[model samples]
Target: MKPICFLLLSTSAVFAADAPKPKPKPEFQYQTEGIQVSLPRADEPKVKAFGPETIKAAAKYLDDGAICWVREKTCVNCHTTGPYLSERPALARQLGMPLEEVLADFVKTVPAEVKPQKETEKDGIKYYGGSWTSIWRSIGLAEWDKHVTGKLSAHTERSLQEMLMRQSADGSFVSYGEVEIPHITTDFELTLQAARAVTAAPAWLSSLKDPELLARVEKMKAWLRNAPPKNDFDRILRLQLAYYMPELVPQPQRDAALSLLSSKQHADGGWCLRDMSALNDWHFKMSDTVVKLISGLPDAASPESDAYMTSFAIVLMRQNNVPVSDERIQRGLAWLKREQRVSGRWWMQSLYRGNYSYITYIATAQAMKALALCDELH
Candidate 1:
């Protein structure tokens, strides 16, 4: 009887060991318009040929994606709708796309109160939902006013005012701190976007009459001038800031930032986010197993050219006076043109914990912006 019991237990253990494991949950799952929707997994398909029709398909994809996000989430996010507003306005007038609806959606995000109540705290800092939203709304509205209407709307002013109200005493704004890379991760990126917002609207800044608002702007400028960049990502942001607000970044520093960015371009004429900073530098808190599972590729320790970085690098270089005729700019643009997926979106692997890769949305937006700046999208 004892031998039979031992043999049965051993058989059970062997069966358990051989059982197939359950699959992991997808990184992104949500409902859109009363229907369950899961974002497609990120992948790099073979490049499609670029032509006039390519731009049209890309435009349709951008418009559909932005409107869908706004209707479903009804909130400003760093990944998709925010970047769509920031970059799409420039192309809308040229492409004859309808942007008023999307623009209105962003303006509605601004709170009516001058100083909204903080809703949460992270690492000892107070955070408001509007902290991140206001800055992005300001940027989006500023872009719309600059490129589309050529006049700042009252809502744009209100959004900027709300953004200013959320500013930290040190001249930076609080970020989501969700560890979402490239944006919503750090105070520096938020501050840089705030700078871009205000500088992009010179008329709004000059028209400011409120003494408190003026002082807040001064504090922000001082912080921008004093805050040191922690990595190459920050440096590229600084180069972008110099384009809009030259006073915050010295000419020599601006030149050095550009040189550093130029040096990081891959042989394929693209840039890799991994090359911008070490994994530790990003300050993520996920475990190794989770990282490997979500990334589902080679470790991020090695550099691989991606759409977000490539389009971002090209846009910043052009903004800072790099000519489209330059070989580096040409190659980078060529890479972008070659990499458009069949869905008309440029694919970028998300550096965040999820597989949503909504970063691809921004990547596509920036890709279009880069092409427009190079006179390829007209």
Candidate 2:
């Protein structure tokens, strides 16, 4: 009876000890709102022909160009062309071919989406800048196409040739707009990107053999050399063009343009596009310094620039071989994560412009690309 009682008491104690503890709460889980990216491993297929030096130089040039725009508080200018040029090498490797084929794919696929905006403010506002559609088409989706083959035809030559055509003796591109544009504005960044696309498609250019187009390209190159680096956007444009057309512009000018941009980098690592326009003009009492001082806007907690600008600046910096560990980079990332819409998208409200799909795509693609670039650099 004593042995039985002891066995029963021991069994009971063992059962109590074996009871499972409550499951610990999970610290991290799958992010439904984050971008779903399964990019191919970079180390699997070894890169050929291009050396680390080339990559480093290209990265530095791109970083300089991007910093220029950030310093100015605008993501236009060099940023317009930055993604195209910066993405070209990676896109080339992704397709396992030369950059020209990717450029051709861009030329073929992008124009279909460029139909004139028939309905405005219905689905979303679509703003028009000369060659803006062309710029967007040339970069975003076209870089991924691997099926493009063959060279430019005589008919295609006309379109490619028009890119170099000078609207005036001065280096600035002429406006199809009724405003009689005299200087390059932030709106023209898309056109700058489109022009870089033409330059990238070397095979197409070689096949076209249009003397007029070649001459015009040379003229634009010459014009950009002396082009004043007034704003961050202008400096970016000049530097981006110089990156591709090194033969046209001297290294000194390029260095100078880059230097101007580096000077503008803010202490927080983010850039501002602070518009100094009179508040009275827009019927507001706030001054430019006050409005430009914040990250996004009054309600936002980070910098004044929109998510689109912040993401783009990050992409540019990563492309130029800048470490993603920079304070500005981290702040920008934090801001991006916070800005994610419930639908897994991000929106950037420009101070003076309406919202649209273009900014949305730019912000999304740029944020994804920045994350990818940072991964590679690390």
Candidate 3:
């Protein structure tokens, strides 16, 4: 009887040992002030880990890169420098540094690389030959005032003057409009950039005696209202522009756009960038001009619920006055906190190799900006 019992027990132990073990939870880590912070997966209860110090850590890493990128790279596109510039003011404050001190030195180096398309088009001095010089320059000018001193730098002032001079009689700041479609790019990025610029000046647009700039501003508002956004990024930017110029977006349109964006939020409370082929007929056709742009070749990682898009979604909702305590906003914020890595960067893969990581860089910077902004309201 003892021999049989021992044999049975031994066999049971062997079977138990052979059984598979459960997998560990997924995690993301980011180092802050030399301390690494790890975040649990969305499925886990720990996804709600929100921390301001992480923003500080991420900003330090990004600021160092911004300075380096400007010094090493002559061009200043949205993917590289614009995102950094956009966030530096908040970052400067978080770091407890003077605003102008954070910006003045770098601001001096950009004007040369940011010249208008032509040195000689007075009536409609457009700036769109290379995208880096045109729309991004306008974006930088808007962000520059958040930290820089005195009036808009002379070059930015001249650029603004040109942009204002060229405003369409009907009022969309569309100096160039090749890119548009089912909802990722914009037809009036230049217009959005212009609205951003004048808003930073605080009543500068309203103060103008000409009334032409003011009227065009109204027309641009109407264009956004009547035209409706077919692209995702444009929709996002339009939401942002509405924040700066509330009168431009009617309350009903505002509520509808917000609902549209919220509806697109994934089950995990995050956002994903889908392939152009995945869109509806009208959208796919609208996005057809650049099929290669959306095809990520597997490794490029299209249609992933990435930190970049997710961060923008959260920030937009928050900026639009969605309460931080709201479950949707909280879940989205949790998603942002959940996806960041221990390296003080979020992993955002590219769709194309040549220009791929630039988007990643932009994503990282924007992620940092979004988190930092969230911290402000909290």
Best model number under lDDT: 1
Range of the 10 consecutive residues with the lowest summed lDDT in candidate 2? 35-44
Writing each residue's lDDT as its tens digit, candidate 3 over 1-378 gives 555655666777878867997555433222324343343222323223445655555665566556555544545555556666656655555655423432444445344542333422333543334432444555565566545443555555544555555555456544332232211244455566667766675335656665655665677677756665645555556677778778777677678768877877777877765522243322322333345655534533535576777777777787898877778777777777777655455666543332224455566677766766667423
Candidate scoring better on lDDT of 2 and 3: 3
TM-score of 1: 0.86
Clashes of 1: 0
Model 2, runs deviating above 4 Å = 1-158, 165-171, 176-191, 206-208, 248-269, 275-303, 323-338, 355-358, 376-378
In model 1, state the lDDT of residue 65.
73
RMSD of each: 5.0, 17.4, 13.8
Question: Which residue pairs come into collision in candidate 3?
Answer: 29-341, 29-342, 30-341, 30-342, 182-230, 183-230, 183-231, 183-232, 184-231, 184-232
Which stretch of 10 consecutive residues in model 1 shows the poorest summed lDDT? 28-37
lDDT of 1 by residue, 310-329 (tens): 98888898998889899989
Point to the candidate with the largest TM-score: 1
Model 2 per-residue lDDT tens digits across residues 21-94: 76664332111223221211112232232234434433433333333323332332222233543354453433
RMSD of 2: 17.4
- Sort the candidates on lDDT, descending order: 1, 3, 2
In candidate 1, stretches whose alpha carbon ends up further than 4 angstroms from where it belongs are 1-44, 116-121, 126-129, 283-296
Clash count (model 2, backbone only): 11
Higher-TM-score candidate among 1 and 3? Answer: 1
